[model samples]
Target chain A: MSKLDQFESVFKAASKERFHYSPQELHSILVVTDLPEHEAKLYTDRIRDYLPLDGENITWATLTGEEFDDIGGLFEGIEKYRPDLICTYRNLKSQGWQWPYSLGEYLDVLTQATTTPVLVYPHPEKKEALEKLGQLKNVMAVTDHLAGDDRLVNFAISVTPKDGTLYLSHIEDKRTFDRYIEVIGKIPALDTDVAKTTITQQLLKEPRDYIQSCRDVLAQHESSPKIEEVVQMGTHLDEYKRLIEEHQINLLVLNTKDADQLAMHGLAYPLAVELKDIPMLML
Target chain B: MSWFTWFASSPTSVPASLAASQPHAHHAVSLGVTLFFLVLLILMILSLALEEKLHAKKSVIVGVFAVVSLLLADIFGLLPLSQAGRFFVENPLHEKIEMPVYIPAIDWGVVAIILGSSVFVDVTSRSGLFSWIAIKLTKASNGDPKKLLTYYGVMTVLFSAVLNNVTAMIIVGSLTVVSLEKLERREKLLGFLLIEGLLTNIGGLLTLISSVPNIIVGNAAKISFAKFFIVACPYVAVATALTIWMGAKLFKIEGLTNEKEMAAANEKVQSFDENDGIESNGFFWFATTMTGLFVGTLATASFLPYIKDLGMGYVALGFALIMLIRYKSEADKFYQAVDWDLLAFFAGLFVVIHVMEHAQVLALIGKGLSVIVKLGPTLGSGLVLISASAFSSVTDNIPLAAMLAKILGNMNTPSSSGLWWSVIFGANLGGNLTPIGSASTLVAVTIIHKHGLKLSFGEFVVKALPFALLQIALATVYVLLFLR
Candidate 1:
């Protein structure tokens, strides 16, 4: 079989694999915070109030940063709990506070630490935060068109506030997409236009399927959220911010690996500051 | 007297006459060479068996060892080399008799067939054809777990008959996990999967190209594909039934007792969209047709002398080339799909077997094993099956098959087909006895573990032991009744 054929088969086989369902009434969410114990409780309680958190649909546990040194240990500490989603509170450093790693470095370590999606709450909530935190009315999951965005989107869908709109958006990095097209076009068997189209389609395939998977997950839920799938062509930060403002998306979720990518474009730290009130779930 | 003692008394050298006039110097040299290769071969097998523990690639280890051994054997005159011109300078003497000659340690035919078939299967697997078929099979069963398990067993056999057992198990096992998960019988899926794993090995016995051991044995015995299929198919059917019955009893998978539960399971499984995997309808059909054609060729290749002479390996290569050309842009991907390490393993095994043959160790083993002939051919065949199966359960079957073929080929015992069948049955079934016995079993174990269904070796033995024993017993009876 050909490469295309192989990919299709794998995609099919993967689709057939059962998505393991935990036999628990409440989805366990692990909240990791660097704040003091009392402050951590407040953050956790605030999150509980903001989202549809109850003993029935969702339950949460809190862990302090000092309880575990590294991300790996932090995950291990909560392994028994089998937390579906990990919410980490990143308290942006004060002007005079001494820290070992920069916000980007710290976020990078935390995200790289686990495959689980991390719901990041930038601490010292802004005024809009309390209002937006109460309900995830409009949510958007940002994707890089890379593989495994499905997991991020799935989390976004699962946690979408009842009857709220969940947007699955991909900002197509044209540079990366073009690089692939250029490489594929060099193949003698493929015509230039055909190669370009094929490469573009291949790039869009995973992200689109991820959106579909997210939609599928949503459809199965008792309170199915409305979904909007968007594929925009431009730089990620600009397009993402635009989508966030336009959709009025309160919760933004993306891969942790993008911390570096977004940082390279001078958008990650600035975006966090700009959207200080928004809860960013870095998977 | 112990058989080992009595066996040693017999002349161990090839032809017996080689023992008569050898000088002490030459005798010492022969002993040294034999012992050296023997130790190396043992070390190689040890490494292969401990492949996971060693954290080394078996292909690299075996490939390097084979090449080094071949060179040493050739240098030491253990492997006799002849001038290429000798064949062209045909004897002007009337009626020249052709005798088998030592050429190379590696069988390019086996290498080609394995690589080509691997590539072909990889391509087909990529098309989601097998997974699609598996889903349809599940849907056809209508949410019945037992029936689904039964269909999975049959598909395992069919896929094993065409593709490698490892690939077959992965597809079947994956389908089982999905089906059972939907049925809310995830717990039972492990036992069902374990049985399906055994079936993959048995399915391999249904065709000459099913497993590596089958390929090695068939090539060694010069058994045509048709002949192999004809002999093994009936036994496969019998063995498959016995396995399913044993599995259902052991796994306690009585068909869904509750109609409502069954209906719920059916709804979930039916919800699966098989077309989600198919990238192109046109390519899927084309791939399906080509797969049918390949299997068709394998089944009929024996009757057509021209194709037979072209060799199974070449035929596989022919299919592989067509695939590469068809997917020219993705040629590199297909090429990358070939299991070079597996090819290396085969090369290593052939080289080691060649060394054994040169050292007359094979003849010695034949003499030792042939002692069972005195008890009768039926018993002798049974013994070979049981012992080979026992040994195969613990070691890689490829080398064991190679070694057994060499031993029994030289023995030229009565009911030759029975002996070959026993080796095939034993080797294939023995693989189900342990995680390391066969690639298929290992893959099954891995897949199950990945799904959070941890099955320890002891647990696997408990699940696999009964079916394995039943299959072997059934095989023994089949060989005695039919092949004899």
Candidate 2:
């Protein structure tokens, strides 16, 4: 109500949330799979070829099917190795992958209960799993809110080959956006058109700004992979599936943990379940 | 007169003249029966208070009490033998007259107002109007902690006045979380939320329909909607400002000390889009216009012809109907969203209170209250205000307000009496004393816990005691100086 208050309000209206990028270090990789020792070693070698963790001192460990039985055993194996990164396929020790409704109990609990970043490759039984992992040429990092996710973006960048392209994509869930907008529409004080446009712009703006910052930072490096931005508002699963197919993306990266709940991130579970033939890096 | 002689006289409807002539006249029920019913009433209140701990719904607790009261009233020959089940009593003339029963005991007017208002507010909330205003206010604070505290506090009051306290708290409390989180000032969240929660009770005193206690007390005193608002607005304004100031001082919520910090704070809030919540332009405009009309109609109901006789409840219901017509095909959805549990609780509560009246329990309470009144209007009113506030701080204020209003009414207290204002102020402001005192404050505590903040009950009481005491003291002075 005062002039000072008025000044502060106007100043706040002109300000925005800024994004900062931080690089991620991948020092150790642990590959877990439900295969015999020889076959597990073979799979680990194939993963080593695709992931661009080239540091000479970087450590690698393999946990075969015979090494662990249940969730507890898998956790014990992971505790023993304590790697910065865990690479595995969906439906780890279960036959649920044969039916396509869930990410299997092992992947579900592993994604949510642990702090270590997980790289979920397609179930090895899928016909296209090996073909999709042949080259990490197109690595796409997807999330509902992409701003300020420096670790996810950095991880995506680290995995992509220098000659490959990296896509930073953010899709605002249309259902959620509409639900909130519908609430606004019922309010008598707001102008509906203004709310719709401004909110849509603001939602898209954060991720775009963050992606631009990514571009700005990567521009300084001569050998950095090419960075591309894909931002849209749509139903997440359908839009993501379409984007992955359209880009012919080799590796998908997304966040799997929810800060508020013990369950896997709402979007990640479905994306992990439905995209059975593509390699995914779940953070 | 003999029982046959009294019963042979035509049973006529109780006249208003009888109330004026024998204001404190009560049935000659046995002291044992009266004490028994009194204990039952206390048990009901205790059960209602421990609703959460017992894990039983409030409606169920009150509903069981209502039925038990009726059965006991019937067993003790307190209930009339007439098929109508009216409360029959002999007047000074020894002529039998019938007092209205069960259905009339539940003030449909109060129930109507709550139901209608709930429907109307719920429907309008879907339009994102509250969210938009909240976002705009957040931006207006420029993300300054002190400024944010002030804006959110005032907004909480205004929302509580128009909407229910719980809705007001949720809308503002949630925005506080998001806004503070964005500014990277989560450390101030507990303070902001706690302050906003306390302010809701202060705001609830603004209008006649703002809270259940206000509605119960205001209706009993026959305070017109406009008069209720005019009388309480000044006190609410002062209390709100004082509470906000106290919260800011106690919580150390301060403005940016340096230019660079201020600029950064300003920048962070700019990202908040006020219009982000709106979806439909037509519905938004319609809801806004209707809300204005609804408030105007309620405030002017007594002055308007035809509506004056129908009372404010019809005005609320009429407006609710108009709004419901917008989504006629899906009207059931809004209806389903209504707080039926609250309505059922009120219904059962009123029935129990009605039986208490028949059993002469109210007259007993009135006898005690009369001693306080004899202390002289100023001192008496002040004592009443403080006492009601203290009682309300620890229990459900609705039943307290209802019982006190009935006692005052039995004592033939005038409509303009300061006693009515005392009850109003005490019933509304008392909730600030503890988290469990009111639904709104409890919600605030829940939000705090949900955000991973630790706020113990003793800690909340210690923090809130000063604000509650100051507000009650202010109300006492206001009643003595003006309303008395």
| The best candidate in terms of lDDT | 2
TM-score of each candidate structure, all chains considered together? 0.64, 0.67
Off by over 4 Å in 1: A1-283, B1-40, B64-68, B71-76, B82-103, B182-184, B412-416
Scored against the native two-chain complex, candidate 1 gets a DockQ of 0.08
Tens digit of per-residue lDDT, candidate 1, span A1-283: 1332333344344443233222222378888776677887887888877666466656778886567666566657678677877776554223311332344444555566655666776564444556556566888877665245445555666667767887877777787777877887788886889767755775576567656655565566677678887875677767777887788887886655554453322334445445555788766
Chain A of model 2 scored by TM-score: 0.91
**DockQ, each predicted model:** 0.08, 0.08
Model 2, B274-313: lDDT tens per residue? 6545568788789889989988999999889988877878
True contacts kept of 2: 0.11
Among all windows of ten consecutive residues in candidate 1 chain A, which has the lowest summed lDDT? A92-101
lDDT per residue for candidate 2 within A1-283, as digits (tens), equals: 1212322332333233344445677788899999999989988888888777757879999999999999999999999999998999888888888998888788888888888889888777775667556767899998988887887888888788889999999999899889998999999998889899988987897788778768887887778899999999999889988988899898898988888988888888888888888888898
Q: Write the per-residue lDDT of candidate 1 for residues B34-140, one digit (tens) a residue.
A: 66777877887787788888888877777777777767766775543233312111122322222222224467777888998998887776566877787788788
Tell me the spans in candidate 2 whose CA falls farther than 4 Å from its real position. Answer: A1-283, B1-26, B80-100
